[model samples]
Target: MSGYVRPGNSQPALLFPFIAGVVVVLSVLPLVRLAMTGLSALAAGGAISVLADRALWAAAYYTLVTALWGTLISVAIGAFFAFVLTLTDIPGKGPLGFLFVLPMMIPPQVTALAWVQMSGPSSPLLKALGMAPPLGSPQPLYSAGGIALLYGVQHAPLVYLALRAGLMSVPRDGVEAALLSGASPFRTFRDIVLPLALPGMIAGAAIAFVSCIGNFGIPAILGIPASIYTLSTLIFTKFSAFTDRTFGEVALLSGIIALISVVGLAVQERALGRRDYRIAGQAGARATFSIGGWKFIFLPLLAVLLFFMLVAPFLALLAGSLVPAYGVPLTFQTLSFHAFEEVLLRQTITRTAFANSLFLATVTALGLLALSVLAGYVLSRRRDAAASLVASLIEIPYALPGIVVAVAFILVFAAPLPVFNVTLYGTIWIILIAYFASFFAVSLKPVVSAYRQLDPALEEAARLAGAGFFTRLKDILVPLIAPAAGASVILVFLIACNELTVSALLWSTGTQTLGVVIYNLDDSGSSDVASALSVLVVMMVVIMMLLLEGMAKHLPAGVVPWRS
Candidate 1:
């Protein structure tokens, strides 16, 4: 499993120690503290209080039910796109894939807000179209089904990404051989492709379930109003209403969330672990099946999907932004930019949020880029259980929900530090540290994948010529992996800039982020301003994605995730 490392070319002496230190600080320490806190709470009879509460059981049940349903929806939508885009002659695959993945990148609360504005009684867009329901009518999205639907929408891209990776690895030779044996396209797909792709499907489902269970934004926005509480939102509510037991109780709650996520991951492992689904082939999978005239049907189907998933809600958000008030209709005469003015100019909090978010994102991206490069190099070269364990540790913080990570960090940093006695509990520094811990996995993956593809002979040769480790990396490795590194930086920046759940809990007055600002605007009855802000954020996301799309040509395949 090692990369092209030549023997006798040892890694830098301090590399392993540095990586381990980072893992311990970012991943292991906070989680260990969380577990300890929860165990302590249980030992102190907090378990009796927590376990005996009907609310806790209800929240857990709701979380599992919604996550399961969301996983099913995600798999269905994601599988359809994965199969079509990877295996068939679909037109505009690149653009379609990119658009389909956009919903996932857009914050879940934003998606929920946009959808809420697109329907129901108070929908400005719907009201303008003379299609809104009566004022007292309940919001269609403020229910359990609504939460599940939005969860699916927000997470389907994950499934698409996971399944598409496996689908891309399907053997072209196997497909061709099956065709030569007179197996029809349908038979070949069902008999060979289906079985081979099952692992990917299962893995995607597992990931979707974890994501859904840990999702705070969707459930917090949709479920809470309807009296449907998921574990994530329940944790938020508990924190919102602070108490003496808040820390310990939240620790227990976070443990539950972590336990559920771990089980899902474990199931994924068990499913993929038992099988050696390796195949022999010269060429990777390609679009072997041409749908021909059926593209007519499929094209419209895809267009409709995109319309609902991206176009309609965005239009509603735009319309809501233009309206003078929440329920006001948008027209040439009534269109207003007051909301934009309020968010971009008048609101000091919003301005502070923008600055804080940009600062955090830039720092986090650059910081992780540096660490990921070092870690990636070491990980790619070292084929040992220790390296694997380190990689998994890096993944733990990321795999758990952002809220859970935030809680863990809070527990770890709530007190003043040892020598400095400086506190990070209510500062931007804590948020930055959490971002490093949470998004390290994102920054490292592409770099590691790029590193694996590199030829090790150059580095070895350079080392033999008396070049030091940094010198060899600068001369040989850096230039070759520049594109992937650039992609990693931008990807982390995009994610960090819009992150809410982590910052939501971590932010004090001055450290508000874009995500928190938007959520706050809407919650404070300034839907128009929120919509306006969401519009800008959505624009930012689109621009970032387009930048990545432009870089897709130069970057390694799969490094730009939305690209095929």
Candidate 2:
């Protein structure tokens, strides 16, 4: 029925070709390649060899345990912030929300590095404060628990965003009616608000779980040192020890990661399968509970969490960068600019990484913007089965782990091109192609939202006057959605610039990205240089966030993450 129904606008036919192209390049080709490789490996007994390895099973167990624990922690911290910030009158909410989300925007490896600097017997910050652990004491964060903790801190904002939407939708009349009926605050929440918000919480948990499973940076840095391997890191290690069976082995691992991610989504769907999330009236002002005495306590509680989440780790990272060596104290006499000087000026690799990351990010952001604008227009205007399929295809590449996408691209381009005989297997072009596939969803979301908010009458009027598709799009659609388009560009640019997992597998000599560079620097026992580079990366992320924050008022709701 949907397939036959006329779409909302005169430009309905344009959607098919455009959406088909994206689906082919990003979703259909890569995923098909991955499945074929894995299934072929199984048929050829390549997987049997991998199955016999005890480390594979051990990594699977550790991945599940840590991801489960991390999801719980994320739900707890994220729900608390979502409830307090959205429902109650929290002071400095703008600042609080911004700082709370910084962990997500910052690179996962950087978060790992910061927390590493903040603790441990080897920390300069700890040594300077005269609070160093005893000699030869193991770093506590190298365990499964430590890795899970960082996973929670990194993904908590996802839960906050998801839950806040459901909370915002609760009918004001319903809340007031419950209050007038003499229901206690706790009782009302348990009976009325909690049921409606459950779906959001479940969805958020699923997202957090998938994120934890796909995460490469956190586990690679923290888990590898202690010999605690997750599925993601296990794949990286397989690449490092390249053999004739390397392709088949990594494909099997990617399949396992994909299965784990699908299971997380399936669990969420099962939990929410039969529930109705609708509230029957307009959402007015949210009901405010009066608790004069609790503010004094709650405010302080919030402040402490914010401090540990944001300030402490950053301060630790700053201290690490200032010291001349890894374990050296940061006294005025010992502090030096040598690390910064080396990363910025002396290391040719560092400069090349910066340039490559910037170039790729810029190209991906700008290129995706052009395609997404057209794709978003079609998706928002057309209501059909094909459109739905197109959307799912777009999401598959982004939703799965970056490592999976990287592997898929590698398999697809491993050989020279058929016609031109050009090789992209070990070039910057392969990485660029992977980025386009990965970040399509990020660039499309805001634009689709923008398109939905517009009335079709403007375009219809243009059509009636004999104006063509391109003319109407330029005059009617583009102007209406420009703010959101800007948001999309900035969001994609920031993410692409700091990405590592995809690049880690794909980068060759002279093509290393910022993420690959940072990971390598730390791995090579140059953490002082790593810290210095990380500080610069963190500063760049902050600047981009501030730019979006300044444009928040003009953009549509939910376009700027920190804004209400």
Candidate 3:
């Protein structure tokens, strides 16, 4: 056993800290430059204003209102679904559960484009039902309400996943005792289930709120047509449409939004600290409640919701992608693979964007995997205040909206500051850095969670037996936690591959990514090409998810303690 102890205390453990220090420096270097340049401009009496304009304020207000409303609706619907699935004997529960999870696999922009096609008056189903209207008419597909609907539908699955996990883990004995004590089903759920699942529910809601607040694609595609704007769109307009140069005022607004998101997340974490519900032993004897007449009603209701939310949007996108024209009736004559051919051959930009997105995603995922593993190891083993602080700060980027980070990067890198005199604008490295920061929190979560399950005594035993840190990490921790790390890496890559908002704002002529290219085509009235690109993105993500699933199957038994 002593022979298993790792040697070289300082050097091996130093690797992660060294790498983390370098990454942190790289991340902050641009911000430092921005502060210096902004200050210098102010001192010279030629500084651009840092306060947001009235348009920006209006946009921010719209964004906040929609996000709040969307979050509330999502939480309520998600909780309802969770309760139904967990407590009631609803028919097709298994299939319904699977269907509810399908939304997460589809990208938001794809869903928006699909809804646009479906809401069109010339759509086949609408025509078949004799409900087709004139060429131009008011539609829910082109308003803030439509954007909120899209967001809620897209994010409800996330909340369901969280709440379902929480609910399934709840002790049945508690609920059973409540029922035996003359509690009604509703009372038992309110007092026993709701309180127990609140932490996960809150976590899910927070995630949804933050995601909805920062999302740009749905609002841009669906909201812009109805003359609605959000903070993300306003930032895009300020940076791209209003002027070629970045505005300090827009940056300030972005910063403020980002700050609010950060504060909200911090407050949430503090309020919920160490309150997580965990089951220490086997959950013996599950209890089920009969829904009586309500089951028949709910089963169809769920089916209709799934049809409208999941099936309709995807089918519409498929129809639109195949149709030659948007408003034209969907007939066999109009349907063709012409859009796909154009996307493949005529659109070099689309192909180039795909390649760039793949490259950046691959790099960012690998970088995040390596960085998070090391950081998690340090945090888990060291248990120092500094490490704890670093752990907390890692979450800041998750709360900060992508558009905000993009604007901040522009402010910092468009000018020279301190040791970094080169402008990184229009470079792929800038995009990679931004993505890395945006997704670091995602990568960190699973790894940290996995690390927490590991016993530090195992490492200490190896160290005492003369094995080095790298050897111990390699032969022990790596093999043990590899599955969690891989899952985190793949998830991060998938997100990066599908990310649009920040990429739309920051992508330049030479650095056009898939998301940017698709948006540009959509903005320039090339909906077919954009639809084709969206299909390709969705396909890529699907492939990655399948691969991840396969890889997960091969992971060692003890790799994912949470799963066990």
Candidate 4:
């Protein structure tokens, strides 16, 4: 165990302290400071004053309402795809699955922008298609229901991924036995598959609900326009108008968001409690379904959904970028490259945003990978209480909403350091640190999973042969787990590049990320520039996904999301 363990098991197990130190600096310190501040304010009647504001409770209520509606919609749509593709004979399952999930890869704000351009009286796409609504009609997507709809669309793939795993575990022998016992297809599904899949569906709902509640980009783009707010957005607004009371107020809101997230996880935990979910041995097989005439119905319905989910909004986004202004009808003659040129060349902020986002994203991904590789290797070999505590600490930051994490980092770094006398507030380093805290789990999970699948005997042999720890890592562990490390890097990079919630609050003038720039451009009525930037973002996401898809052949199964 010591031989295969990271940094060995001596008192000087440097790996443990290194990991613990990281968790302390990145996760523990920030959250503790925020909690301490909030607690101090609560002792001073800050909670009462903050809670007295009608907007805060209204935002909380709106947050719950939208999250509930969004979860239901996601389950309805995502479970359909998950079940049909996994359990039925759906045609083009690969392409359908890929298309169904593309919306999730696109950022939430981009999703909102695309849908806005696809709907409403001001839609360039709608006008070009001669389907624009009449004058003076409101932008339908600016309503609470519209926000819920887009949230559902954006988070459905999360539900799909969660449920697909359960669907895959449905035992074929049981279905065959039921059929032999003269059970109808409906009866077999009702008795066997649905019961077995209930836990997964419930868990998926919980995941979607948490995501919707934490989502800042969607509501910031859609809800704020209608003067609506969720707890996440309310926190942002409170921070935007920073004041002496701002820290306490935002900390109060962040506590509410954290509570909401905790409730969600608790519900999932309760739903999943103590149940042995393993299917019988020899259960892995294709879903046993034969609905010959139902093919037409299933395939076409899925195709239409794919079109709406992936094709339509992207085209609308493209059209929005092409038009000279928001409501102008897009035509071959009307379309021009001015928006693209201005964004890609002329705007200094655009250039800064690109460079900053790329730098932050790359650094976060690579840095976390280095840390996760060591931590994952160590934790995989050691399952003591200390390791579990460290693991739990690492998860706390990622489990909280990005907004809460941002607020925590704000509290942690708001003041100048004790001896250094240098403050990190309003700096790019702050955002980078926040990204590390926010995305640490995303980077750690894949590598840990890969470590679990590896055998320890080879490393033990290396130790018996007197090879150093670094030598074994270089000659043994790194070569074997490289693909998982790559996957971890890509996942973190994808998420960090598309991040808006944390940066929304933490960003200063020169430190804007892609998400901040997109939101700001739209907020300032530069719809053309926003749309152009969004189009570029969408392209980048797709390209990176394709890159991951290409690398999937060399990787273990389930690393690349789109790959079957």
Candidate 3 local lDDT, 288-351, one digit each (tens):
6878999878988888888888777666667667767666556766677888998888777877
Question: On TM-score, who's better, 2 or 3?
Answer: 2
Give the Å error, residue 235, model 3. 1.0
Would you estimate the TM-scores of all the predictions? 0.96, 0.97, 0.87, 0.97
The positional error of residue 446 in candidate 1, measured at the CA in angstroms, is 1.2
lDDT string, candidate 4, 1-564, tens digits: 464444544222577888999999998899888999899889989999998999998999999999999999999999999888888876788778877888888889999988988899989988998999997999888988998998899999988988887777788888888899999999999988888888888888998999999999999999999999999999888877878999988888888889998999898998889555667735566456887899999998988988887789889999999989999999998998899998999999999999999999999999999999898887887789999999999999888889999999989888998999999999999999999988888888878888888888888888789777788888999889999899888888988998898999889989999999999999999998999999999999988887777788877667776565
Please give the distance, in angstroms, between residue 140's alpha carbon in candidate 1 and its true position after superposition. 0.5
Evaluate residue 547 in candidate 4 and report its C-alpha lDDT on the 0 to 100 scale. Answer: 73
**When superposed on Cα atoms, how far off is each prediction in RMSD?**
2.9, 2.6, 4.1, 2.1
Give the range of the ten consecutive residues with the poorest summed lDDT in model 2: 1-10
* Residue 536 displacement (Å), model 1: 0.7
> Each prediction's Cα lDDT score?
0.90, 0.90, 0.73, 0.88
